[model samples]
Target: MADGILYGKPISYFPNGYPLFIALLKLIFSDALVPTILIIFNIIFQILSQYLFFKLLIKLNLNKELALITLFFVAIYPNQINYTRQILTEPISLFLLILSLLMYVSNKPFLSGITGFLAAQFRPTLIFLFPLILIHEIISKNTKKSFLLGLGVILCLFFFKILEYFNLILPPDNLKFNLIVATYSDSFNINWELARSKLSIIKNPLSVYINHLITNPLDFLEKRIISLWSLWGPFSVTHRGILEKILIGIRFPLFMFSIALFLLRKNLLSKNILIITYLPILVITFIHTMFFSQQRFTFVVEPFIIMHTVLYLYSFKGNFLNEN
Candidate 1:
């Protein structure tokens, strides 16, 4: 930030929105105060995320009590709370995504697109959702208006890439880097040392990545499945006590059951609007699984997951316990 502000250099390695957010804070407060302020800001977003999540549940036809139960889960979810302490984009981006969904569900496509675009700036993986939205719009024959809304998102993302192309900001190479790591990292039987050495010397890592996929198709597919499993798998925190483990274990089966019910019973994409709204989850899941596997990267979709899960559990009434 100092280098960018002082030397007028474009910072590109990460998305410009988040670093600029930090820079603005640094301008107002000292370096020591910045982390504190950022964390506070993240906490505020976390609260807002839960609030909007409650609204989303209501929009989904869930009763207020059921919505409140979902909100409780959002508030207490360890992973959701854990990320807020760190000065990362997930908290804010997650909040923005929920807000975007709210707007979309409320029939404000332009505003939803704008908010979603901002969220994408914070986390570029979100750009994948826009294309899915576009596909939905076309399939539903929403015509130029819907197409334009989707185009707005594409334009916002393209603006950033254009800036990168001109060296106006940092290069957005994280996706490429992650792809290289996913292909050649130790998970695929290539040790980090060797992978790092190869990547370090490669002039065109993407080409090599493509070649690896061509020659080792099974490895690529296997790694993506492993990534998906990790994303939705049991919640395990390192160095936690037995009680924590037990709680997570208890939640795991219920969570899985909820997901199963959602996939089998819920017509999430049945409506045209819903198709455009929630298609991002499927698109993002595939992209994240293919290129990266961090739980944090998939955090934006958790509120919906929790909401559906809670709704399913609540529907069972006492039967959920009786059967168990």
Candidate 2:
């Protein structure tokens, strides 16, 4: 797609923002060098994201040692590190999303909005977070900050519109296709061919989803239950290597353990900061339950899980020592 755009054949698909950015890079440097450059950028983004994650932990009042432990875990997580080898949106999107949350906690709402907008361009599911943040600010009675943040997002949207007007890029044109594929359970396979068959007959994808919910409520619930498992479970429907499978197996239990701890001990931590961190994670998880769910999709929010888990472990240790 980036090559097509460079050669004057821009195709409209789901969120071309990352490809468009890649095209810009290709225009600047030789094609051979672009891959190397992207790998370097991915590494840099990962490093910066870790730094911001640590900063966020401190801002939320976590002890330095515990925060460093969380940072180390995030830095070494297999899924997080493996993506740097490929030319994918995860690295940049993760960096920007973490930076946005840091800015929000630092009381820089405008900067938060700008980074959040950039993150959403790479991963459109993040767009749900902006309205949630806006509502959060309004409820907190920070009207001025809310307005500035909203203005920042609106300015970015205007810039996107200008790009669209000049044909520099195209709007997302694959929502119906995504929705159709999402309707099918991905427990065994994606079955896109079957989804396409359904899409051909269905005029409105939204109505199809709604009618499915209304007619076969039990089936709808079952599919969603499978999707939730697909999103977080250690097993995969597709084939994976033994080493990759082991990493996922380790990660899944840790994620669930951290979540259980957080639920039981949330009141003991900084509620506001933790809420800010968890809100997007919850939103994306819910959205995918309706659409499609995959481990890669869940990767965007795994850092928070790491943080929560590490925090809980340290707190537990401290309490144990005092008890002794």
Candidate number of the best TM-score: 2
Over 4 Å off in model 1, which ranges?
A: 1-6, 154-168, 186-197, 235-255, 267-278, 317-324
Which stretch of 10 consecutive residues in model 2 shows the poorest summed lDDT?
315-324
Q: State TM-scores per candidate.
A: 0.82, 0.91
Query: How accurate locally, in lDDT, is each candidate?
Result: 0.68, 0.79
Looking at model 2, the pairs that clash are none
Please write out the lDDT profile of model 2 over residues 69-131, one tens digit for every residue. Answer: 888888888888777778888889889898988888888988888889989989888999988
Give the CA lDDT, 0 to 100, for residue 38 in model 1. 91
